[model samples]
Target chain A: MVGAGHAGLAMSRCLAVRGIDHVVLERGEVANSWRTERWDSLRLLTPNWQSRLPGFGYEGDDPDGFRDMTQTVAFLQRYAEVISAPVETRTTVTSIRRDDEDYLVTTDRGEWRARSVVLASGACNLANVPKVADALPDGIASVHSFDYRNPDQLPAGGVLVVGASATGTQLGYEIHKSGRPVTLAVGEHIRVPRTYRGRDLMWWMDNAGVHDERWDEMDDINRARRVPSFQLTGTDDGSTLDLNAVTDIGVALVGRFAGLVDGKAQFSGSLLNQCALSDLKMNRLLNSFDEWAAEVGADADVEPSHRLDSTRVPEKPPLTLKLAEAGIGTVLWCTGYRPDLSWLEVDVLDRKGRICHEGGVTSSPGLYLMGMQFLRRRKSALIDGAADDADDLSEHLAAYLDG
Target chain B: MSEATVNNGVNADALVAAREALTEAPQAAQFNWRASCEWKNGTHSHSTVEGFFGLGEEQKRSKTFAFDADHPEIFASEDLGATPVEYVLVGLASCLTAGVAAIAQYRDIQLKSVKATIEGDMDIQGILGIDDEVRNGFDGIKVTYEIDADAGRDDIEALVAQSQKRSAVYDIVTNPTAVTVEVK
Candidate 1:
């Protein structure tokens, strides 16, 4: 397996349980991404209680709380020890190609031959910035969410955050709170309250089986996989962090970042419609939870269901902004991430560079993928979700080897 | 289940098959639409559309379609026909409305009626060379849909949202596109 992150480690536990001999290769330390890529204030979106893997779960006192990056790294490190995973840290795989009946993994440290290989390196290895980024003027400093650590690392001026997913909203909120004027470029995003009806929103999703929705059951699996992360934040009080939340705190809200034209940052005029869409979808999700609660007779136990206020949209959102003139020294692209599979020498990638896979099984025989959005289930990328996917993929890998 | 399979005047199965086929043969999906325009008078032009290239071959419509574009009288020009911007609004509305119908049919939601109203706000300062800061195009565009369908309010809203998500002209207007103009 490639990578020693949660996905790789979880799969290792599953393989060990199944009596399969395998080694996990890590480019850095275990949970390397959590140790480096995450922002300073970043925390796991899922609550602590849900942090679980195969035969391993979070035993901390703050079950209802979210784990910060440090806590998350420590948790995963403990998991690696508890599972006694055969993890080779600081070993980076340079290439993986088919070598006759077996596969050859050429790493910087050395090389190894295996009957099968699992790619759990991760989905967010590289930031997927748009081509329009090249049009920005020379004055502004551009930073992707992966390299962004804190507001202090940015120049002292206004910040224009592009995108409204979980990363964008959180960074926008945090940067705005740090005494910097922020303008958030909104787009189509999933909105969910942090807490609903006296319980965490994730609790509702878990109980309602929203996260367990399998890929095959979806009407459009491609769309489901491309769906953006929910506009949410992990806070001590579990308070919501949506567009309205940031707007309430004096952060200017704009439309989607359309392009940079004539040195001016052009924004889309679909702000109201995008907000309306997100509001509608959020209410629809809440309504489903309410119906589920009523059907299961669980409504009497929890607080009464209520709807969140609609996303507040400005009557006249700014269509363009002159970055330098507006004192906007930084343009943070919190758009999204893509898997970095440049080293894979196999011809299994699709036109979009994504591995063609059904669940975790790739089109190339005996090659598997893990930790991708909606890989097998809706929660396939969540911290608590790795075990279930690992369990299923490990079985498939074993079968492929036997066959 | 049987009633759900009822066709709502749309060949959704054929569309799905075409989409799958085009996914495997993306070259066939490379379509080039064409329109020719002739200057009639001051700010008035005649445009014709009849043929387009798609499915890896040149294709023609059953009949030629023509349109007249002119500035309104407020711009000190002839009010011979609708303005060019108005045609853009028409394109966006028609494309989105068609998407709504197609998606509704595919989802098995019988539609009773669908109406769309589109408006674009343009600042003429840029076109008049009065202000370089102002853009030559619409400052913003708004589209509203009123529909009576078999589905609920949320489902209808989803139809409009999905329509916008897939509309070609909506993307063209919302995002920047490259255009080249030259004289032979």
Candidate 2:
């Protein structure tokens, strides 16, 4: 197995339970990304109780609270110890290729040959910055969410955040709180409340079985996998974090970032439509939850169901922003991430660099991918979702070996 | 469910079959529409459309189609026909209207009448070369649809939204496209 993150560690536990031997290769220590990639104030989007592995689950006192970066790293470290996973730390795999009937993994430390390979490296390895970023003026400091640590790292000026998913909304709120004006570029996003009807949204989704929606059951699995993360944040108070929250705190919301045109940043004029679409979808989801609650006779147990206010859109949003005139110095790209699988010398990748897979099974007979968004279920990318996927994939791998 | 093969004057079964066929043979779905225009006078021109390429071969219309385009007298040209920008509005309206009909038929909704009003706002300063900051095209375009259909208000609104979502001309007008121009 490649990587030593939650996915890899969970797969290791599964393999062990199945009496199969495997070594998890990690470039750094266990949970290397949680130790390095996340910002100082970042926390797990899901609640602590949702942090479950194959055989291990969160045993902390604050199950309702979120795990900050430090806590998350410690939790993973404890899981690694408890599972006794054969993790080879500080060994980065340079390439993986088919060697006749076996697979060979070459790393900086050494090499290993196995009959089957599980790619659990993760999905958010590289920030997907657009090509128009190169057109920006050299004086502006551009930072992807991957490399961003805090607001102090940015120069003293207004900032333009180029995506309004979870990362963008969180960082925009943080930087705005740090006394730097922020302009958030909004696009297609999923607006979900952190809590609903006196319970956490995760609790509602868990009870309603939204997370367990199978990939094959979806009408368009590709579209389902490409849906943006919810505009949410994990906070101690469990406060809802959405566009309205950020706007109430004085963050200027603009349309989608079109391009840098003639020294000025161009924005789309579809802000109203985008907000309407998001509002419509949010209401639809809440309605489904309400119907479920009524049908299951759980409405009397929870608070009265209510819908969130529609996103407030400006009557006439500005379509262009002169960076110099607006004193905007930094462009923070929270535009999402893509899996970095350049080292995989396999022929299973599609034209868009996505692995050709049905659920966790790859086109290649003995290869499997883990930890992708909606790999087998809707929650496949979440911390708690690894166990089920690992079990299914490990079963497939074992069966392939047996056959 | 209705057993009829046609709904709202559209052969829904044939449409679905064509969609499935194109999905199987995507190369045949690559259609190229063509039109030829000749300058008639200052700011006035005539265009003809009789042939296109589709289904992996050249195709011809049953009859030759023609159109005349000219600027208004206020723009210092003959008011012979609709302006080019007006033609663009027509394209958007027709495309969206067709999409609404097709989708409504698919959803088993009977339509009585459909009317669309399109307006594009433009600042002439850019086209006149009076201001470099202004843009030559419309700053914004708004389309309003009034449909008398056997559906609720929400259902009608959803139909219009879905039409805009699937309309080819709507996508063309809202997004950027690459075009090349050179002397032969």
Candidate 3:
């Protein structure tokens, strides 16, 4: 198996239950990324009920069922032990080679041969920062959302958040509340309520019934080919931070920072437009909340038809910025991240340097990949929802073994 | 947002040159995702072989396309299951599997079928919700590589490293990105 992470350990558990012989290799300790890399405030967006493998349930105190980052790692560690997963921690694989009728995996620890290999290394290994970020003044400190542990780690001055996605929004709220002047860059963000109609997002997800669903119920494959919009209002743990609380807290709202010309931070674009977009999404989310409320037979807290006064972002220019000129000392890039598959010295990849696979099947006959952001399902990437992907993929692997 | 790419000309060359200069300059300006450490510094940089640069030779992609609500499911939205992240996985898996085929062809190993699968976990509240307390992207992703080759386990595992996909999208994603924010 690949790196023993959330997906990897879960896959190992599924395999163990089925009495399948598989080895899980991890560069760090078991569930190390979840334990070490995630922020202290991190929690599962999906509730406790959603983070289960085929035979395991998140049997904890609260069926409200959301867990913090620590709880998550603890659970995964315990699960790894429960199933006796054959995981080798701190054994980073250097290369994967194919010999006569089998596969050989090289790692720092040692070498191992197997009939198949599972790369459970998920997407977090790569931290994506923009090239332009380096253009800022060195005097000003800048950090990605990954490194942000608390507001204390941030500078005393106000912060400018580049991305308006969930991390951007969450960090913006927390840091702003900490009395730091926080400014959030307006990106196209998908707004979903933490509690829709007084129910958790996971409940709504289950009600949507897309989990363990037929692929066709989703949009057509051709339609699925498009990329996704960035999201802004989901929860990290069971609790979702409400943006409504943000503007009330006096965080400086900003437009996309236009190019920093000659070190003077230039800000263009109508900040008001971003407000309008937020209004639209909030309106939509409110409507969704109302619908959910109706589903659960309850009254809605937010009225769907209510409109509010907001500004529009100027069309002439995206928001522009210069670190020194604007007195902006710190920038937090909430922009998204990509994969780190460079060390993988295999060739099933494409000319464009992407792995070729369909529904988890690589171009190579027996090579496989799992646990990507939305790897197999609309819900596959969520913390609580990953086990579903692991179970499904494990079944497929078992099938191949039987064959 | 509209997608943009500078390719196959002085524009692309200048872009690379400008990106390379970013490593030394510590300003958080634009996002640089190149896999080579010749452009190093950030903890986000590919420092280890597992880091960005150790992946593979760069693949100079010449094209990019934008996606939106109109055609939301193609590379962005998770409508029919697949996502840009999944595409990245496919790209990685595909790269390594192709490497397997290449190695087998080069070594005269018996020709046989090969397949691989990958998976990742991302912070939903961070990526999906409009909250800024969380990070914008995934915390850490896990990839599972499966191989079916006629070669022995050692040979196949070694060849898997030959994949260009690891260096391209995966490496780029793994690197740290910088951006500027303006507050009014």
The candidate maximizing TM-score is 1
Against the true structure, candidate 3 reaches a TM-score of 0.61
* Each prediction's TM-score versus the true structure: 0.96, 0.92, 0.61
lDDT-based ranking: 1, 2, 3
| iRMSD, model 1, in Å | 1.3
Instruction: Specify the CAPRI tier of model 3.
Output: incorrect
Q: What 10-residue stretch in candidate 1 chain A is worst by lDDT? A: A268-277
lDDT of 1 at A115: 91
- Per-candidate DockQ values are 0.65, 0.33, 0.02
Encode model 2's per-residue lDDT on A1-403: one tens digit a residue: 9999999999999999999978999999999999999899998989999987988998868899998999999999999999999999999999999999889999999999989999999999999999988888878888999999999999999999999989999999999999999999998888999989988989988889899999999966877998898988888887899999999999999988987865698777667767877777787788889999999999998999998888998777787898878899999999999989999998999766789899989888899999999999999999888999999999999999998
Model 2 / residue B161 / CA error / Å: 3.3
Chain B TM-score (each prediction, in order): 0.94, 0.96, 0.45
**lDDT tens digits, residue span B49-154, model 1:** 9999999999978999999999989989989999998999999999999999899988788888999999988888989899998889887788888998888988
Per-residue CA lDDT of model 1 for A1-403, tens digit only, reads: 9998999999999999999999999999999999999999998899999877899997978889999999999999999999999999999999999999788999999999999999999999999888988888998999999999999999999999999999999999989999889999999999999999999988998999999999999988988998898988888997999888999999999999988987799888778778888988898899999999999999987899898998999999888898999999999999999989999999898897888999989877889999999999999999888999999999999998889
- Per-residue accuracy of model 2 over B60-145 as CA lDDT, tens digit each: 88999899999999989989989999999999999999989988998778888999999999999989999998999998889899
Candidate 3 Cα errors over 4 Å, as ranges: A211-243, A266-318, B1-184
lDDT of 3 by residue, A117-212 (tens): 877787767667877677777778879987889889877776888777677877888888887787777644555556644566556566655454
Fill in the DockQ of model 3: 0.02
Overall lDDT per candidate, in order of appearance: 0.91, 0.90, 0.61
Model 1 clash number: 0
